[model samples]
Target: MLRPVVVGLDGSRESLTAADWAAREALRRGLPLRLVHAADAPAAGGSDLPELSAPRHWARRILRDAMDQINERYPRLYLSAEQIARPAAEALVSAGGAGELLVLGSRAFSGFGGFLAGSVALQTVTRVERPVVLVRADQTVEDEHTPDPEGRPSADTPYRAVVVGVDAVRPAEQVLAFAFESAALRSTPLRAVYAWRLPMVRAVAEAGAHQTEEAAARRALTAALAPWREKFPTVEVVEQAEEGHPAQRLLSAAQDAGLLAVGRPIRPARLGAHTGPVAHAVMHHVRCPVAIVPHE
Candidate 1:
């Protein structure tokens, strides 16, 4: 059986945006879409509030409304809805195991306040084995495509390049494969960005030594991506090595990207936060959709 694209919905505008993004992705991948809503368990003695007393009913309504809107937009798409009686993060992480891709919504923060991914979004991304895409509340299809020459909207605009952050010293195969495959699927270029910085002790060593270090970094990145480039011959690959912070460079590279892919080291829930600082930063700040891929 083909795995379906799953999305967590909570009747919030952010979640609705995620559903929209997931629907398009499902259609692109020729997979079914599953919408999941987690209804929190009622209070110890059962509260007097109607919503708390009938949590399932409220969840069903949220799902129904979402299903209706998605159905109207994609009548031919196969869609299903379910309600789980558990905490939102737990429900999403469990559902993610059986999904090809799990999508969640995050509200965009204004100015430099940073994003609010919520506890559920952060926890789910850290724990899920599959790739989890976080879509901003205001993200739209047009944002994923390149603008026309006249700077006007057009349906025929091609998608922007797919950007992937790589740690040359410890490249993740899963992350590289996902980036290459996504670029191939969209028939777009892949930008592999690897950022490095000279240690403080080595900053004033020598000019020639600095050049050698830079060369070595570039070679490492090339070697790391060689196999993936062969695997995806049709994908145009652009390798970039910059001397700076990884997160800062990635943020710069993602300015014009359609999707940014980053790797999260797989860590057991008991070990606390698993997402690295770079992945966490990009997920919250990148304007385009962000894909958090888990790898061992």
Candidate 2:
């Protein structure tokens, strides 16, 4: 069963946007929305006297006001929030044990930033067990300043498109199902993308051999997805097969997407240098909101 979608709020603009998205989403799904804020206790500053940071106290109070605003603005949304005396990621991870989805807002941590996501957003995406959603709060506000390239309001979505990234993994079925369900709800088309890179590039000898192998690869990919297509016949399946890095291809496909869904293994091994390559890449580049699916 899908559990509640939990969002992390650190009283930043990003968190607020994340909260707004989560609220609307939870209401649409008839699911409860859990808003979590983690406030760190003031550290001792050399002198023995424990300094009571007024800002810390005020932060907790701000959460109450924020929650109230959500309650008032989204009357139909089921919303609740909690504050912990720990880091944001830890608090959210603990909450994720029972969460169906975890969401965060991307911030620019680099003081001299040109482009990139903040540490907290990136770390949460890598470490969280459940599927996580990252919102680009920086763009949400800045987008207002620039003229719309699409020549329409950024929020002017007559409909939302559901996009999913699939590879050769068995877990992809879960991701596809989640995307189909979402598309069904929104009555939008479900675009399925399967990115590939020939593992044995050096094996091919002839120039025409590459085309032959590419056709075979595409055929095999379609055969794998046939079962799901048979099941959700109404779902408009837009298949894409490209030769490039999995992450890069997936992100490119998601650029015009409303929601991008990817699957996670049931048991994720402890993240070493870089957990899984595909998901890591998607977390960094995909501009739209991302939904992660976890297997039972």
TM-score of each: 0.93, 0.80
- Per-candidate Cα lDDT values, in order, are 0.89, 0.69
Clashing pairs in 2: none
Model 1: worst 10 consecutive residues (lDDT sum): 107-116
User: Which regions in candidate 1 have their CA more than 4 angstroms from the true location?
Assistant: 42-54, 268-270
**Over all chains combined, what TM-score does candidate 2 have?**
0.80
Count of steric clashes across candidates, in order = 0, 0
Task: Judge candidate 1 against the unseen true structure and give its global Cα lDDT, from 0 to 1.
Answer: 0.89
Q: Which stretches of candidate 2 lie above 4 Å from their native place?
A: 41-56, 108-115, 138-151, 154-157, 169-171, 199-204, 264-275, 294-296
Candidate 2 lDDT over 179-225, as tens digits, reads 87777766678777776666565446556666776787678668767
Best by lDDT: 1
